[model samples]
Target: MNRPLCIAHLYPDLLNLYADKGNILTLKRRLEWRGLEAQVTLVTSSEEARPGDYDLVLLGGGSDREQEIVSRTLRRSRDEWKAAVEDGLPLLAVCGGYQLLGEYYQLPDGTKVPGLELLDMVTVAGSPRLIGNVAIESDECGTIVGFENHGGRTTHHHAPLGKVISGHGNNGTDGHEGVRYKNVFGTYIHGPLLPKNPALADFILQTALDYAGIDVKLEPLDDELEKAARTAFQVRRMNLSEVAAQTP
Candidate 1:
């Protein structure tokens, strides 16, 4: 008998700010729809989150204050996360989680907050704030739609993250958007992308499957559900492009 896939979510310190739990629920439901039992574990600041025990790990967005809280906890767990990544454990980190994985984050006052150094990226915090919908053109995949409300822009050194297909990404200026290091996927979009974009969810889940060495047949979703998800993603993409063009 195959056990259910275990997914662990790092609660950090704040889970309500960006309301990123939607991503987790989206994945869980999607898996359930595919007849796969999914189990979720939330590891808070007080709890121990060992990445090796889980098949998938997710981290949500948070504020600077909350980032501090999560970063502090991550600093202690850095070794575990680094090891997990090195060992090819799947990870999905968004916004503040993305920032904390970078080399550093520069505040508006020119104060530089050190990051976890997990990914070779730097975030310039005091920059053009991008709030609203975002469209990204993936190098590995296709159009991805989500919302971005952030005060920082992340830049990758030596290696570039994923590409931007539409909307202003990473400070609403840079074409360099999102970070993809190894099997770790970090993005700034926070509309809890999975619910509205099932392809992206499939992409992530497939990655997890590959990592776990599970060679089951990839199930195809129903036409109605697929159409709905694609339509939702398109609406978001078009709406964001309109907003971006009108903003300036």
Candidate 2:
């Protein structure tokens, strides 16, 4: 595995709300830190690339307007994209990117943003948005922490990444937080999503390595700072729901 892993970062310019591009940096740096090489290519509507053409793909959060633009871009490569995902391409989609993987995300005023339909799910705008720190319990990754802020209420038909340990998940009603299908993952978690959760990041890299036919178990890296961040995170990270539940 001397060759660099090709990473396609989709819509960095438009879908970069809340420093979403940080996830891309997190992935690339993690690979390098492990003595592995990774090459990232920015893919936008103008630079649409086949999802299967890369070792990994990352779609970050964005606004509704940006989602519409990306939808059209993806529509051009729809079949190819669908084939790639079905073929087990390791993809991580966050926030608006997560919604893009579903059937459709219906807006408050009745405008439905078209999605890639890769996942059997739908997001409809709710009255108040789901926001604040998120804690999910995953059997594979243990307790994962991040921030989520969205108005969409998603109904998932796919297996959930984990149960909600804190904060609002896919929908406040459901105890789940993200979607897991084949090698593809969709989540509303963002705090740039990977820096605090190294296990999940490495899980994606390992899956990508496996998908790319690279025979290697990922070497573990020290996550002391990441752990410390989580420890400190409990101090100020607030969730309205948690506050309400604890009220006497």
Candidate 3:
């Protein structure tokens, strides 16, 4: 019997603004469908993060106030997380949580919001929040689909998760969508991010399982509904782009 996959969901109460809990649900259901046992634990602001205790770590988006609170909490466990990542633990951080994984997030007023420095990247707040359905062409995970809504423009020296194919990503000027380093992934894409992109979800899960010393191949699940949802979002984005281009 395989060991149950353990996922530590950070700040489920606060950093779940964009229905990010759906990502956790997607991961759990996928594992259950494959006849694998899965466990998800919510790590709150009061709790210390023990990354070594979990196979996968998930951090979702939140409002500015909520992010500040979580940032302080994450700082307390920075060393633990750094060690865990070095040990090959997988992490999926999105939006606000993604920003917190970087060097620092600079506010519009020039205040610096400290990050965990897990990834070699920096995010600066800018005008006109990047909000829309997005598609990206990834080198490792193929095309990824999601929605992004953020004011932070992230710039990284490391390899990007993917190149933008549809909507504004990262800084809007850059064509990149997210940052990828080792087993850690940081992205601005929300839409809960996983349901419409099962491939990406599986990639994270597999990585987690691999780190857990499990070598079982994952059986494929019926992703017909998932694919259709992705296609519909892509079509909608295309239509919106066409309309914007034709206007004026």
Clash counts for the predictions, in order: 4, 0, 0
The residue-level lDDT of candidate 2 at 95 comes to 92
Cα lDDT tens digits, model 1, 1-248, are: 45677888898457446667888888888888888878888888788778888888898888787787777777887888888898888888888888888878888888777777888888886645777667777766576777788888777763434566665676565686787778888888777767666767788888887787666545867647656766777876677668878996
Candidate 2 achieves a global lDDT of 0.88
Candidate numbers, best TM-score first, in rank order? 3, 2, 1
Give per-residue CA lDDT, model 3, range 1-248, as digits (tens).
78889999988989998888899999999999988888999988778878879989899999888888888888887998888887778999999999998899999999888999888889999999988888999888899998899999999998888999988989999799898888998888887899999999988888989888887778778999999998898788888989999999
Candidate 2 to truth, TM: 0.94
- Find the 10 residues in a row with the least total lDDT in model 3: 212-221
TM-score of 1: 0.88
Name the regions of candidate 3 deviating beyond 4 angstroms.
none
Query: TM-score for all predictions?
Result: 0.88, 0.94, 0.97
Give the alpha-carbon lDDT of every model.
0.77, 0.88, 0.89
lDDT computed for candidate 1: 0.77
Q: Which residue pairs collide in model 3, if any?
A: none
Report residue 107 deviation for candidate 3 (angstroms): 1.1
